[model samples]
Target: MENVAILVDGAFFIKRALHIFGKLTPDELASKLCSYSEKHLARDRKGERNKLYRIFFYDCPPLQNKVFHPYHQQQIDMAKSERSIWRLQFHDELRKKRKMALRLGRIDDINVTWRINYDKIKKLCSGRLKWHDLKEEDFSMDVKQKGVDMRIGIDITSLALKKQVTQIVLISGDSDFVPAAKFARREGIDFILDPMWAPIKEDLYEHIDGLRSTFPKPCNKKKLESSY
Candidate 1:
């Protein structure tokens, strides 16, 4: 029997799931992932079950305070936020799940800088902006996730090269994985991409062996975010 390995972009999945499924607990998230893979991704063309090699979830530890609201100039308390709390809980759940591997990336959270948006800068230059008029999305944050993409790429390549799994199902919408996907496919792995019912580019489609989404597309599809 063929073996399938499920790779999840944890940050992407969490953000997307919260937006679409409305704040599922960690258990719900794990169950959904398992259910989806077993019922959909881990199936052969002949409708046979594939052995689940492992489920790898990649993410970074949440920012450890020190961030601030650019406009308000108030320190953002990540610890007290419900989102942060739930994410930690979710990580714990992943740790406890059978055959689940939680691969964490380092958070480049040492610096807190706000890079102003292009439009906002234009507005500022035109003297059309005031301190009180600024909104959160008017600027970009520089909190980078170090090593996440690299780790994911390495894992995919390793899985393919070592022949650990015949099939790989990647649950991510990020096009950043294109090269890795191509490599996996070249290695004779059945590479599948699950964007959680999100639309992918034509270029991405050409690289993967198949596209599958275990979840149903939202009825309010337009309102759902295209990517995380």
Candidate 2:
């Protein structure tokens, strides 16, 4: 009797699903996730009652202030609205500062180049081009309101330490979780990595007991019907 616990990174899962399936209604996304979990459990021989311990959903809410492109907003809204699962947990304001830093660096380069080129292009046309209002405050980086990684790390570590679950399933592709996976393996738990719709890294697979991509299966029609 193996007890399995699933830890899902909501933001990562939603983004990957959107990229893979195109636009999906909230119900559609939830159905896909439910199907994914069930299939994994079946494959692991733990789909039966009492064998599956619990599924822990971990994710930070979207940056409320940052303007999400319309399509992204739809997906984000749908994920937050899902509240049917008892094990689901919400962690808000989890910011990805490193990714943000990299984006800001690229924006700075674009700004410098635009400053040099914009005036020249305008002069050639004998006209002035007005730059859109830009502000440093718009690019400021701060702590994520949700702190997803911290929450996820804590849950994985605590569960592994307590030996509550014989197997752990992580539904994320972020390399930030390598340490947690390693720790789980050291504690003799079978760590499985399932990047629902994302690419699985070879290095990540090396640290886990197995790797499974959950994007090929059909989504749960029942859940999709409810999302709308």
Candidate 3:
């Protein structure tokens, strides 16, 4: 049986899951993540169930400082905010799961600011709506995660160099991992990409061993299929 390590890009997974599968509770999300990952361990055409080495989840802790919201016209305490509370609970739930390691990065609070949503920005650009028509819901905090990508790269390199796992399944749509994927493949580690049914560029095919999405395909039928 192949030994496999699953690495999850927490933000990407959460965003995609909310869009495709609707809202789920903190515990529900954790359970769903585990269940989805376990599917990769199912027997292959060779009839061998892959053994799980471990699961690495990368994310940034929610911002805990008070920040002014220009659209809402109020100062918000993010530490007590609904999203922050939910994230804290979700992290706690993940800690109790076996074979799961949460690698938390820091949020760039120094440069954090409110930014208009992409949809609203597009509407404004197309003259479909004016800036005055924007509402509080049209704005979201723009936060850049620090150290998350570095941690992911480091983990992948470590796994490959140490010969820890025969395969690495990365659950992310970001192409920043291409270099790491190349290194892992050179080390004889089977690198798999799971974009969660999101469309990927044709150029991304050469870096990985295979592509597979464990979830149902999204409504848009223009996604790139598995490269296996």
Candidate 3: residue 219 lDDT (0-100): 78
Model 2: per-residue Cα lDDT over 82-198, one tens digit each:
331311221221121111100000111111111224434465466443323323222222223245677778888988999999888888888888888899899999888887645
Superposition error at 146 for model 1 (Å):
0.6
lDDT (Cα atoms) of all candidates against the true structure? 0.80, 0.57, 0.88
Q: Give per-residue CA lDDT, model 3, range 16-82, as digits (tens).
A: 8776667678899899999999898868779989899999999989989988889877888999988
Pairing residues by index, what is the TM-score of model 1?
A: 0.83
- Which scores greater on TM-score, model 2 or model 3? 3
Off by over 4 Å in 2: 43-50, 65-146, 217-228
Clashing pairs in 2: 27-227, 92-145, 92-146, 93-144, 93-145, 93-146, 94-146, 94-147, 95-144
- Which pairs in model 3 have colliding backbones? none
Model 2, 223: alpha-carbon shift in Å? 24
lDDT agreement of model 2 with the native: 0.57
Residues 62-149, model 1: lDDT tens digits: 7657577777688878777665677787788778888899999988877656787777788888999876677865765666889999
Model 3 gets an lDDT of 0.88
